[model samples]
Target: MKQPLLRYPKALVLLFTVLACLSLRTVTAQEIRIVTEELPPYNMTLNGQLTGMSTEVVQAVLKEIGVQASIQSMPWARAYDIALNAENVLIYSILRTPQRELLFKWVGPVAPTHWHLFAKPGSQIQLNSLDDARQYQTATVKQDAGEQYLQSKGFTVGKNLQPSNKYTYNYEKLKSGRVDLWIANELNALYLVRQAGDDPTETLVSALSLPDLGGDNGQNMAFSLKTPDALVERFRQGLQAIRSDGRYAAIAQKWL
Candidate 1:
């Protein structure tokens, strides 16, 4: 500048370029807000820490990508809403339904799940089909995938469906004979029954097993639509890498 500006030394220019690239990478690295609900064996609070089958898979995926994120446990509806409206948010153990296909970018099939209508042992509630279930009062979690699926099949809330804020409440309602059936996942229903101090095999019996409503795949990690495509792809690749490297299987074996 004092004289006529001259080109910087090659070494100095290279150093500056490297620094610029590092800064850009640091600034662009997405900060993920990972959220999940207290669905035991999948995502739950254990000794004040989040650890479950789906949680481990998500943690492994983030590790594969060198991302550090803290998983939070909340209500399923709250977690779902955050994942839907916030950038860089991820909700795990989400059922990948046809109605939810275009709502978010998916990163899994983290685990498989089956939906069933559960009833008290020896209860006269017989459900041979989805329509058969419509005649009895069913307990379901509000805004839950299972509830949505039942609603899609013509089940109406306040008439035949009793919506609760938590799955535990639904279970309680079933135990107290307040509801005819409870919509629950096969594994999760067992876990819940055990938590309620009852033998699952003797407490709950499957009345009807619904067809694969989760796009026939499984539960997945869903990211907000506003998240960067590159970031979503990175997570997807990270998941695939973990699956191929045997880490995913190890994690699944830990909980399942």
Candidate 2:
């Protein structure tokens, strides 16, 4: 009468085993969480869509690597904090400063960023050189790469105008005369001007040309230190594929 007849519920056992396998796979599949601020022509939402140069470039790489990503549009500070403190998180199109170099795994020089200074129409603040603009009050996003760059260069930022969560505020500051100099990438400045329905003829934007800052071009994507090396390699391979296949160039042409 040994165990000739007592088979445990085979169907139930199989169901449990299947569910466990699925759970394991779900846990193992590489996932990267993204947090981004509203940096326009790069990560801004147009008509509620997250369509920008960096956004699209990243999406293409992610698709090629077969990893899924969840993007949250939030303040840049919050986003950077999340990437710094959380696992499997990344910040994108960020400048690769020496201080931040060891902080995260990095990828991509997606495109060049030409740092420019904008002025209101008919304003007499002339910048014959980067040194010339230091005398005037400049408006910039708090703790942003640009701010850090200017501050490092001994550019005095007066009144520290309201923190800009998006590029649009630069236009507002220029229009209201709240800031004598507004620093931004040229393409983004153009996007802001276009959004205001103003032609370039109505306003003047000049390149500040920080030679030290200009070389890197500020086009980098970064992943949290917590993200696995295997996934990072996947991202690298995917990036290479896109670059070799001309996908990256196409994306750039669309926006830049």
- Candidate 2, residues 1-256, lDDT tens digits: the string is 5553336578677888798656534533645677777777888888987879888988898788766777788877778888888887768768777667788898666667777677776787777787787777777876677777777777655543344666677678877887777887777778778879889767755635454553434777788888766556667788889989999989989987
- Show model 1 residue runs off by greater than 4 Å: 1-30, 214-216
Error of 2 at 172 (Å): 0.4
Candidate 1 lDDT trough over 10 residues, lowest sum:
1-10
lDDT of 1 by residue, 18-90 (tens): 9865653553354668888999888888899898888889988878888777888988888889998987888
Candidate 1 Cα lDDT to native = 0.84
TM-score of model number 2? 0.81
RMSD of each: 4.3, 7.1
- In Å, residue 32's CA in model 2 sits off its true spot by 2.1
Structure candidate 2, residue pairs in collision: none
The CA lDDT of each predicted structure is 0.84, 0.73
Q: What C-alpha lDDT does candidate 2 achieve relative to the native structure?
A: 0.73
RMSD of 2: 7.1
Error of 1 at 112 (Å): 1.0
